[model samples]
Target chain A: MAVAHAANDYRLGAQAVADGVYVFSGRNEHFTRDNGGNIVNTGFIVGTDAVIVIDTGPSLQYGEQQRKAIAAITRVPVRQVYVTHQHPDHYLGDAAYADASIAALPATISAIQTQGNALADNLYRLVGGWMAGTQSQSPTSTATPGVVEIGGRKLRLIGTAGHTAGDLMVYDEASRTLFAGDLVFHDRAPTTPNADLLQWLNALDQIRQIDFKVLVPGHGAVVRDASAIEQTRDYLQWLSTSLHTAAEQGRDMVEVMNQPLPERFQKLAVHDEEYRRSVSHLYPAIELTTLPRR
Target chain B: MSRARAALLVCALWCAGSLPAHAATAVDTPVDPLNSPSWQYMRQRFLGKDPMVFDARVQVQMPSAAEDQMQVPVHVSAPGLTDVVDVLVFADLNPLPKILRYQPTSAAPDIGFRFKVEQSTPVRAAMRTRDGVWHVGGAWLRASGGGCTAPSVGTGQGFWQDRLGEISARLWPQQPGLERLRLRMIHPMDTGLAAGIPVFHIDRIDMRASDGRLLASLQTYEPVSENPVISVDLQHSGPVRIDAHDIQGNRFAATVTP
Candidate 1:
């Protein structure tokens, strides 16, 4: 069990899920520097020969401190750093791990290169000095999706699209641990800024079939069963239905935004706020698809 | 660090060094250094050292966050400006943020319209209320970011292509002798915020009679939104026409007849 960290602690306590498998669990909360920008859960697999780090956090400070956390565990050289998605919190710290060969999808790489600086600038404004010395860094390698053998562990690469244009989930055959990047937000509200809800629903189905003992989500606590993925799907479906119905009814954005949050999402941190922001980001695309040309 | 990162770091340092120099000068100066050069040139061309007062009486009502950065609703009104002579609107972050140079014909002129807000920026409205005192009111609208630089998300490719210089206008008599003229021109209004997206926006517009009697000639900057919408209340209604052109030398003209 991971020790409950007080707010403002940058030091991470890696919780052991199984033999040689550990996760640096982030606070199931919003992105704040006091929490060390630990708004996303990242994983590392220590093998006999090497270590593979998953999803570096938001900034240079985070990457540097996370490196220290890794040092406390095993000194196995980090073979590759997989940036699971395009969001600033996931890939902006690739610069901090400049030594490691950063790997991401070719599309995600392009996105990070094109929109990365703007994302960094936005994060700088959002988190202030937490982004200091951290500039945008695109991935170093666009490795093809396949089974990546790190030391002796077999990581079956699963490519899923929905939460973003490219979402990567690695399932370790040996450990039965699934590293589900922003695809599953566990208990917290999943972000849908660039989501295709239909595809997101489909992606959840793919995640469900994977027989994994431990499921590490991008933003929340480790999932023990399929309930977390189902919760995410339910939220996405509700959001999609709400947006589609509002568009069909010719309801304006203000009216759609004021719609009360469903009882299911009430338990998530920042659920009300994320729902409001999601409505702003995703509603227009939904409206565009449904509305006839003027 | 690579050579590129090192050079970037040097440039970052130089920018940081110059920021404090500009920071002290910008206390209530209503200026963003990144967009200062164009602002200075525009200031020299438009109003030079005019006495400007920061006033709260003049209400500049605008959204806190623009759902669509391309079309931000802005309403500027001075309730008791019976002798209003001039009004100006501008944004600090736009390439040529100076949106309007208005000479209101009505003694009590109120503007309620929508325009582009490129980034999270202050939309300033300056009014000259006959006394020659320029009362400036401003409201900061949090943008989705990159209005001027982003292509129209509502339209597909070739959406603005061949559609440039296209003018749509409606001139109708509303109140006996008064006429309401609303003009919309199709343009991307790119603010140069998006990568590889250059600044392309309608630079100027003139609403006039067919005989060349100018009703209003608005000198605009880059943050004028895509498909710029302008409405003017005219004291007289007759054969009216509008001549508009972007910075790219695309010309459009539309005439509304009785």
Candidate 2:
């Protein structure tokens, strides 16, 4: 049961799906101040002696709100915060939990250190003043890919470089819910700014092989079945093949971007926007690869 | 009344001498509204109250939208024509819009140039013929500016120091009288977008004849790709010299003869 909290300070409706796992799902929209930078799924698992926060939201404001909401739900000590990836939406909020042991993949932490400030500047540019005091904070810990035990709870941390270089996924044995960071966007359109589509396909196959009843994605609504994973896989494959074929045929970027979207993915949120961005991001490199060496 | 009649007589004589013998007017609808304003302003600024109709006689080939705001490729070409005097290139929305004024020395017929752009605007080539009529041609390109204020991607960690001040310029006849002059220099047109990387770029170029008589000159800003190489049509190639400088006032010069 989600214990009621102060609506004004923490309005996130934490839904308890299993015995001790509660998730606060963000809206299927771009980061905006009105939404308070809550554009990703944040989950907290209540262990016997501590709480595990999975993927803090985008800003300190969102992280603080999530922390208060979790405190309202349980009195357990929030032991560790696992950042799913280097994307600002998933890790910038760790600033609010400065005292907590925040852990992320080694590559993810490095990215935050090198390109993190640039990403923070972009976040402010895209979304207005909602991130007034928000900034990227380096993770305090590196959670290697293995079984992490906290407060008698056994959680599996799997590392995959799919959507980004340091994409992370966490699975709970007790709840059977997989926190598939940016690897899966569920019903929403998956962003591929730093995607390796071929590896992303392999990552999806890995997710399919995992034993999980609930899939909490970083961007969209939580899924109860593996169909969402398959849908995302299909979308990635289709767009990649389409662009690859276009490149082989000597089609320019403008022509490739105007190619019709696959019928199956026509209804995806931000389909056009993401499709345009993906074409711009991948086509130039793909074209260079196809060109004759100097 | 006597003064007014004399002015009318002068105007008629001038119109008679100025009108083309056979005017094949090129008609094209204005670009989209958000974009049309810049090009319109450019034409008004250059053409004054009268805007010339476009003609394929002078064709401009440019990317519809630039992937890299800096280092945009532009090519202008026209078939062999004796009336061709010079070609002027400009980007309607660039901070310094007038990019090139190509005065063919040996009667150049082909030109290819590149520069930086700030936003979506028309990349135009206006060819002035012997009759003093401008035949316009253009292509629309969109850009996310900051080329002038962004750091050079390839110049990090003091790499630009090794190649700075190097100049490479050459010219050759495309066939006979038509020639191509390509003048390139080593410099990073840093746009100043990155933290701590200041705006560094070659901002001006003066093309002079063997006698140092100005053939063409233009003001450039960042968004012009790192290591700017400008190719233009040239007719008179008698020890032609070019002098250029960046925002920091670092001077570079080169002379080539064919």
Candidate 3:
């Protein structure tokens, strides 16, 4: 799960994710795991008519790389760049694809406006020199999704928060490929701050309801079946359940982590160090005895 | 006699001119090493020197207030004192007090890295010599805080059972015998970021030569990014064997011949 290596490898390769959908994975070599998603920015070339770019990537340099990837396919005027979320990695590079109406959920736009500057500053410091071509400012003040389109080409934009307050999953009907933005993890666990464990399970259920042939994770390799999604869902559910049980029992956080989790989960990318924190966040939410009833 | 008296007068005059208006007389204060705040655990746990005298001039670069403490970038530099052998970073407030320890083969005194800061607390970087004389510096950083309990960065659980072995050393020899060894592993490095998951941490990584001699050994923590990329200076004089083990002794070993 060396995300840094992934970012540096796929700068401008027009690798196909689905039939028409092409993912332009950005350079992977970086200090930290630039959690924008392994796929630098995703998009598709629709015949000779127009090309719709999915996400713009983290910075201006990333945008340039995504553009070059698009150029390899078709010179068609880039009509629209659909941003999956408000996270800077998905939307900050919007300026690079100028003239294309930057599209996103209204909620994402608001989240960007609210925390863009602060997020940029925080990320810039963490990334150091890797943020060379990124937007100088977070664009928090000015970033408003110019053309907010909901569903496109049978690909539904599902509001899946918890990972972040404003996360959306793009479901392509034709390809049955769900571009899960930090929602699914094939190799590692998803980082969740605004994590509503229950809401996340519900969201996973929604994702499951859809019949998808392939699941394109926000990071890692593409998942080809529902089983992958199930693994992720089960992991979150188990964590919630375990944390809930601990909180219900009035157990000490440290003591709970010291106790081994389910053997099924030991191999799952859960960090031992983070056990206490996970318990703290989920303990309150899981304290509700009516989870099973819900 | 006369010459010594003249020198003393000249020194006194120079001090008077250089002194600030509110300068207080320099007092010979008792040095109580117990009062100084350094990670005693790191000193006792790791094989390092003790009674380290901390210097105040060397300050670390960190935000006054960070919005996100998940991956806070920190830079520590020792401008002078080339004789120092290594500088180790330790945080008093973090769950893992020892953040990173750099044993530099080169002459570079400055080392910068991106790591997760748990909370608003003082971070100390102690530099020690071959003779075990430790010189220390520290700084207070106000991070957004949430490392001890932050969620895992991965999507699901752990590394794929298939990919677990892939976590090994990938060595590319720039020239003959001298190789640039990039050893990567699939580790979650769960810095107590999230809730529910149990404690699973890789405590020590011993990188040794084939002849049973040690090249470099790291006492790691959850703060190190997942699948920590450790680049070691390998001379390729002998075959290499790197054995990395978690706190639970789940050993992942790799071998390479540069």
Worst 10 residues of 2 chain A by lDDT: A1-10
Candidate 2 docking class: incorrect
Candidate 1 regions off by >4 Å? Answer: A1-9, B1-115, B118-140, B143-158, B162-186, B189-224, B227-258
Superior by TM-score: candidate 1 or candidate 3: 1
Q: Which 10 consecutive positions of candidate 1 chain B have the poorest summed lDDT?
A: B25-34
Chain B structural similarity (TM-score) per candidate: 0.70, 0.67, 0.61
- Candidate 2 per-residue lDDT over residues B85-196, each given as its tens digit: 6677877777667776656544454565556677778777777777676666666787756654556656865766987867665555555544555566678777665578
| Listed models, DockQ each | 0.05, 0.07, 0.02
Q: Cα deviation in Å at residue B234, candidate 2?
A: 22
Better of 1 and 2 by lDDT: 2
What does the lDDT read for residue B173 in candidate 1? 62
TM-scores of all candidate predictions against the true structure: 0.64, 0.67, 0.49
Candidate 2 lDDT (Cα, 0 to 1): 0.72
lDDT of 1 by residue, A156-246 (tens): 8888789989888888889899999999987788887778889989999989899999999898889778888888988888888988997
**Residue A207 lDDT (model 3):** 75
Q: After superposition, how far is residue A206 of candidate 1 from its true place, in Å?
A: 0.8
Those runs of model 3 whose alpha carbons end farther than 4 Å from true positions after fitting are A1-10, A25-47, A136-154, A252-294, B1-258
